[model samples]
Target: MRGEGSAASAAGGISGGDGGASGTVPPPRGGSRRGGSRRGGGPANRRGRRRVLRWVASVLSLLILGTGAAGYLYYRHLNGSIQTDALNLGETKLGGSKPNAFGQTPLNILIIGSDARNDAANQALGGATETFDGPPLADVQMLLHLSADRSNMSVVSMPRDTMLMMPKCTEANGTVHEASKGLVQTNESLSRGGPGCTVAAWTELTKIPIDHFMMIDFKGVVSMADAIGGVPVCVEQNVHSRTRDGKGSGLKLPAGTTNIQGEQALQWLRTRYGFEDGTDIGRTHAQHQYMNSMAREFRKNAKLTNPVKLNSLAQAAIEAMVVDPGLNKIDKLFDLSMELKKVPPGRITMTTMPWIYSTRPGLDGRVEPKAGEAEDLFRMVREDIALDGQGSGTPASAGSSPAPSASAPGTAGTAQSAPPAATAAAPAKIAVSVRNATGGKDGAQAKAKGRATEVATLLAGKGFTKAVADTQTGAEDTTVVRFATDRQAADAAALATALGLPASSVEKSGEVPGIVLYVGKDWRTGDAPPAPAPAPTKAPDSAHPLNGDNDKACMAIQPGFTW
Candidate 1:
């Protein structure tokens, strides 16, 4: 309920009236007054006019009643289709990140695509082969970010193989999980409790509060695609996916565009080996393309304006999803959609969490957070920064009202207002001191020893010759950079950029002697922070950039995937 009051109006609202233009009164022909001849005519003509009027009145009455009844029935049906789940992921604490200038805070939603094969039909879709009702892995996880002003949306997908420490979560049955100390696979969070647990894991990792979650199983994908009519996808070459043992998505398409729905849509999303490099990263890119195109299709088709299409879409989506109680209403979903649709396709972006191959032998083939780049992306979201540098707004009325800009992470303004001014001193010339506040005599880092010195060495290697370790220390949850004087603010900001720390983590401290850093538990092991993130206007090279309607873009097939 943190943002319930503003979620409706700030986000656009879709009126759910039946689609059609209102009937208009017609004018007389050739400047003649309507019914003038009938009025002047004899008794027979008058009688005829009276009969016609009666017939018209009767017909209009029936039409009105019929329309009202149909509309009510449809509304009830759509509402009934939705399934609700109490998001008993335990209490969520706000990260205290600043809202936009207008006092509107961002909304983060975790969408989970579960691989539960509970039914016979679902079992055929391919999942864990052992048991039908057994716990399932969260196959697809995407965090959708709605900007504070509702101007732009960013969908950040987390790979299933990525490892992270999950926060303790409470299940709907009143069971509680102790907070995990060791790094665990992210997908396991779902099995621990429910989709709420998945949300909790993310909250623990990013420190970003999640408002709600919408989860769907394998069958939901098929139903949703069918309801949306069809989503168009393209590929660069002919491909046929299959494995020697007959395990695969069974997807086959010629080297061009295809309108996929139902099973084909599921295949397109689930395909991995034939998509790009045959890794989860490659599959994630393909999913982004499908989603981007789907958004364009929804806008182009005008589902909200057409009652039939709208009802079908609403029913299909609702029936397919298990949502947090907060988002279980059709109106809420429509409002959320309208908010998202406000941003032009060009402004909406889809990116994956940066990751690296796991080195631990037991977890081989798995991936771990790429550290710097991943944190940088999360920080951008936490601050409500648009991925694209340009301001965002509704494409239909962008000329009339432009959206606020990505002035700085967690702020709004023109690009000119973004920080790290051109006159800031170079990194090498700026003095920096890092304190290992991860723990004390009996703390986690105490056993590791000399972590502050190690990080200082890492900083020195990055060209900050004056970088050194500090003696003062206390427990800190996240890493932060502080500067003593306003003059050194730019230098502190520069150092944060180099270390890939969020702009929110940089603060002014009058008591500090120089640019000082306190390395928190978040950075106990990394050699150095990730490279400075690209400006909002720029994207990391690894990201697959596509506008909402990138009709010309096509997925490239891997060598073995060629038909």
Candidate 2:
């Protein structure tokens, strides 16, 4: 009865405005029992059966009650075991335009999984210090997009290795760091300003608004998965993981679709060396699959509807979660749950930003946007467009400027524009250059040059009177459209669209002194537009072939369960 009351309070506070207080419900009257007893055969016979049945029922009820009580107590123990206050989720304003969906405002949630282990709670949760001895980086940074229509949702993973201008951040202990102190690593940003600073950094870099953030450490993830029984995940190949240091290792799973819970789930998510590429990208894709499978499994499990399981999950989430204080209450959590419940798994899409190794001088290993690629990706999110289909824009060239348009203010050559950078008194011509960067195919160079000329011609028509395509060996795979400054970059992006180039093929080259254009394999110079993709073949009972109609159930491990 207490457990039931607790469930009612928690759910009611979320569903209604009860403030999560306990309440008492009156017991049933005695007349109903008497009437049922009278309907039985004879008074003595009824009494005997009722007595035996009551005894058996009472024992069974007690056993069930005892199990529930034990489970609840165990959850309380787990909650007490965690250090919930170690990470301070600093204040973050909801930035960017409101997202459109289901009459409910779109929400951007920054989901962070930290590698912090300096504290005792973290250490107990199997968090260990790396030999490198740097502060914990964001092991996982995913931005969840709940669309305005509530018809779709997506998770965009921002790679830790991305090279970006990190905004100044104040640490938990009131330490301040500058964004302009040279290019900084993405994960280090989290260590500096906590989640707020990370959100700030993303906002500054991409100019998209973020709504909320939720972070969970290793312990929380493991325990949550365990509580959920297990998360179903599909593995394309066999995986065996062994840590060289031996602190965290020993994961072996046969290649196929399987339900992974607890330690096994953690291993699957954390394994980096097992993949062929062994890059974070591969690991990211794996995590995406794991998340999808988990969503599926959670939906399928009937036990999840049970009060015991629901209580366990809620308690675990509350204990392990370090969410924005605004979301600390049960009502807020329930509201979020209800809103998110409307979104089906089929509408949930996932992707990583298009990136390549950072080309900034001397930063060989780090990754950066391959020109305008990241910007375009961010813009797509801002616009709430589906990244998977034709709805997605083309990738811009590395370093291409933002598109100049009536929509974008303070852009180059606009009605209220600033003039291009000054040359000598003669007003030197800013010649545009293009080279065949797509590695050797006969006539490719000439074709690229011709296309470049055509693009230059388009630019000239748009008041870039002196634009001209360069004839040179631009055989590198990278197609960069450089601009002199923010204004010029904007101008170049606008011209790119009119020139019929994919936005991805155009990029702002921070290295280039002036506006330039680069093209990649995905682009072609032509007057006529390409045909749209054919519709997917529909199933007999389905009108939309690509519609994700079938529900795929999955499970996630609860926080405390062992592998």
Candidate 3:
């Protein structure tokens, strides 16, 4: 099939190498099939299943050791089960990355939780019961960021309901899905061109190079949870999932912690109707907590040392995922997992992308990326800087020096390059016009009460006596210090120094009088702009910082979900 050929090409493996039972390049054992054996459940069938299990267990033992001494014995069987898909359109078509000081490149993988009921097992899991096979939704999307040195890991979630532009993508069959000039729900990318299109949407939005992707379906989720034994979750109060009218997830649990597995685990992940805020954002928090616990469990379980457990997990994980060709090999996945293991859980941080509720007509309840805030995150990731201050010796935390813009190097937070007149202006003599340009897609400003006046007041306290709040607020992509003429360039430079903006951002507008300090989304709420000088050793506070190992908090049950 065309799909199989595309997948095989993606894995970078030899063509026609070890095809699997599904008529695909790499097929899984019969036991990995969704339902029981196609043949009768006789004594011979039972014996066959036992032999396969035992053979798998022996192969896993050798793999966990990493010596590859006996790899040839099971390499074909394991490799054949993997399914690969195209990773990206092209690094050139999509902007690529920047290596760290060590010359090691960072890895960014898009983890997709696909709700694709393409067969009987998936259909039984639930969603639009009328059809046997339905279009897939990339419902739970998380971008897993691994630092170049593997010192830290960060996972950032994008809400499924976020409305954004999806770039044009080509499917396996050579059919191209055109870009939506207007906004569409982020999850729609999956149905358009499989998981590859979803990766394209992220690259377009963040401009961060996506190395690869791994997609799992409804059955995959259940199988994975079972293989891991169970994961721990918590709630602040007694919660019941089902609604009064029967539109709930059918999950009910008492207050405090619970070790949930299988169907119960699926419910915990899919119970958005009765969780905190009853929204996807709340569900994202729950997922982070679950992932953190799962990591801890893996560390504690020592599955690699136990042949049975290791084989079970390895088999389940392989059967559950469709990954990029680069990661299609058993050794490749093992190596990646080892790299991830190097980072301690305490160094891992999980956060949701900054976004605002949408008010666009017919798009109510959806969200759009919060412009300046989201870019700050994307820049950090692209530059290979750690959000938690634990990556390499160079920390990209709150107070770290901001990266210089690609267009203008050595302009970030440096005062030596400022214009002469900028040094001559006294603090009290610096007249500034503070404009609040933190408005929305429409003309509506953020409901932040008197934000312009507040910022101007802050400037006044800093000795800019003439700093007055502008009556009009507009939408701006980047914060800037603009001057009306070239004569005022020095003054703009001085103001940029005060606001920690790069000198490249200062420009002569030939319109606004004095220094027009257009406050973008970056400093919308802060009392003062980030200082240009070296930040204190202490880390800067992030918007929604989630510490993986240290957090033990439970979900606060919503009013409706409470029993």
Rank by TM-score, descending? 1, 3, 2
lDDT of 1 by residue, 435-460 (tens): 87776323655523687899889888
Candidate 1 ranges beyond 4 A from true positions:
1-73, 76-81, 86-92, 95-98, 119-129, 303-313, 392-436, 439-537
lDDT of 3 by residue, 1-563 (tens): 11111332212111111111222111111211112321233321212111111111221222232322233234435777888888754211232334443344567878887656576655544424433445666766778788765678777778777788777887778787877878888877887878888888887677677776777654444444565577788989987654443334445678999997655655565555456665556666776777677667765675345455445555555665678877777766655555565677787887788888777776655677886677677666666667777555442455654432211111211222212232437767878887877663344556355777988887787677888998866655456677775556676677777666765456544347667888776566786655433322212243365776854768877675576
* Model 2 spans with C-alpha error above 4 angstroms: 1-96, 99-104, 127-134, 170-175, 243-248, 390-563
Best by TM-score: 1
Which residue pairs in candidate 1 collide?
Answer: 372-530, 383-410
For candidate 3, the TM-score is 0.62
- Local distance difference test values of all predictions, in order: 0.59, 0.46, 0.58
lDDT of 3 at 397: 51
Candidate 2 residue lDDT tens string, 337-443: 54455566676666676677655575655677555555555666666765444242232244764322211111211322222432322112445655444443223
Could you give me the TM-score of model 1 versus the true structure? Answer: 0.64
Better TM-score candidate (2, 3): 3
